[model samples]
Target: MPSTWTTTPVTAGLVHGALELEHTANGILPHRLPARARAQNTDGQLAMAESQPSGVRLVFRTRATAVELDTLPTKRIYVGAPPRPDGLYDLLVDGHPAGQAVATGGNTLTIDMSTGTVEHGTGPVATLRFTGLSGEDKTVEIWLPHNETTELVALRTDAPVEPAPASGRRTWLHHGSSISHGSDAASPTGTWPARAAALGGVDLVNLGFGGSALLDPFVARAIRDTPADLISVKIGINLVNADLMRLRAFAPAVHGFLDTVRDGHPTTPLLVVSPILCPLHEDTPGPTAYDFSHLAEGRLLFTATGDPEERAAGKLTLGVIRDELRRIVTRRAADDPNLHQLDGRDLYGEPDHAELPLPDRLHPDAATHRRIGERFAAHAFTAGGPFGDGTG
Candidate 1:
């Protein structure tokens, strides 16, 4: 069992921050031992298996004594996952050092704070110790490990947090692709969603998942079941990039997703957002890639193109989808006054593109994340705005 110690002076003030953890395959040991008895199979050897680690657990505590948390039933947690592990690992608050006992021979490590035992396995788990916390109107954050591939499995507070104040402040629930999920963002709180939530003074529920926001029914169902005062769905770019759906099916799927949410939040303010400007997909659809071979030659080139017929068919541009969404929402707004629409480009456009080119032309950079967050907060949460009514 691992030992614990209380670090220095006991500060009485509240500790309002996040606890986070991230996972990847960068430092994992191989499962099978090297073979010395048989010759290596050099010919047509399969490439190294992709090291995608999942099922990570994180636990932590808060020190907010003056705030009554039972009113806020749920707390928001942020997660980040990059494709490759280039010496990158997730950040853990008060985590034990990695070792054979803590990490074993596998990548997955389990930290059971309740028992002070840290061990390695195929699965990972971390526990948060919320021992001495009492407060009123306080917010605590649990930041996931940074710069790693991990998913948030569950969240529960030591005590149920009170719901948002009935008379003041608004809550914003925004959903989008990996960009909103902190892809390429510097930190969990630095993600645009978190940034926007802070700037708007609203509670955030970041449902952004890396490469997982494909208008999935499960996602929409999760949103439907969740309670929110304001909500927005950012769509298009991911669908186009993944080639997830063609025109015939995309529109209906989006409508159905929204329809399910509306059944639960009939009068709540909801916004449908289209994609920002992505030049590669603006005129040409794509399976985009960067030419890394030129790195040694002191040059970098990016290559991206999609099915010529698909481009010609006008099937994958953000403009096309935005038009469809606008029409859909406009038609629905005839009876639903709370429904609204916003074009993503309005927040980040070609003009801004000159200054903030996306790192991979898919996810925004850190600076752009800030800019996008500010723009979103200003538009969606200001007084007299669609979401300002506070009807949740």
Candidate 2:
């Protein structure tokens, strides 16, 4: 029997997040930032992560057993370095994990960082299909890759598709580093934020950028302007890793970031979380160094190279940043009762580390992402937590 296929435009209404959408020559590129936010900085790290579609997902409804999506992903490759991991798209049917896929068609951007050179080549587009659905009207969610930039081309289903109705759940707007960006996670939906959203029953807008979460003013403004019932900002690591600021500058920057967000969400429940335990960086300062010794073996790892003595000279460390953040939130909460703080250690601490070690000496593994997400839900989204309902 022949079936009619309906094509959907992949518009903003069908997407859960992405601060802005760019109409690329081939398709629509979902950006984690708006034009104004994007215009402020032209840094390479920001550009890459902003377009990775970390927390972005395609959500819709249809009574079709089969569906297809076309995408043009811009996968990055570093010359003479470990191969880049493939981007994954996780599909959920009626809120349950149903399938997974990777886009095959796209262009490749190669960079020779050792010499500061680059090249680009075109590739074919990929058509991802999902079948065996029950044909009853159902909600479908396709989570895009968190590490690769993708341009959505088209969405086709056996039956007509429409924007899924809002789930009526509270909106959770979260910002953090790569770990929160789903780094090293097996699938997009397996990212900690995605898992937490599932457990908390909230709509998620992830602004997690791999190495770009340095307290940028533009990022604060983006968060300021976004509408969210609950908000969280995972601070520390990036600043330390980049060696961007000193203890003197860190405090004011933290205040400024919070100030920008408070400008818009004055009364919304806001949570500030510090960095989890990273043994190598606990007391050591960083402009961390890459452990390239295993690069030839097709493995990548990171290590701290900064001196621990630098702390006396105002260098920042995860340990120092954590204490400062807790102090900042506590002082602010004195007057603003809605403000709160959570020790990220509680999510991925020494005990958890004993059982599940960090593979890269940084980002959590798939199982840890799940454990952290579940812990976050219990601590921050369950009854009596900051995002808790009024009943508790």
- The models' CA-based lDDT, in order, is 0.54, 0.90
Cα TM-score of candidate 1? 0.63
Put down candidate 2 lDDT per residue, 69-173, tens digits, no spaces.
999898899887877777999989999989988887588989876566778889988899888887899999899998889989999888888999988889999
Q: How far is candidate 1 from the true structure (C-alpha RMSD, Å)?
A: 12.8
Error of 2 at 287 (Å): 0.3
TM-scores for candidates 1 onward, in order: 0.63, 0.97
lDDT of 1 at 120: 41
True-vs-predicted CA distance for residue 367, candidate 1, Å: 0.5
lDDT of 1 by residue, 268-376 (tens): 9998888887776776665555545555555444455675567556566676778888998999999999998888998899999998997666678879888898888
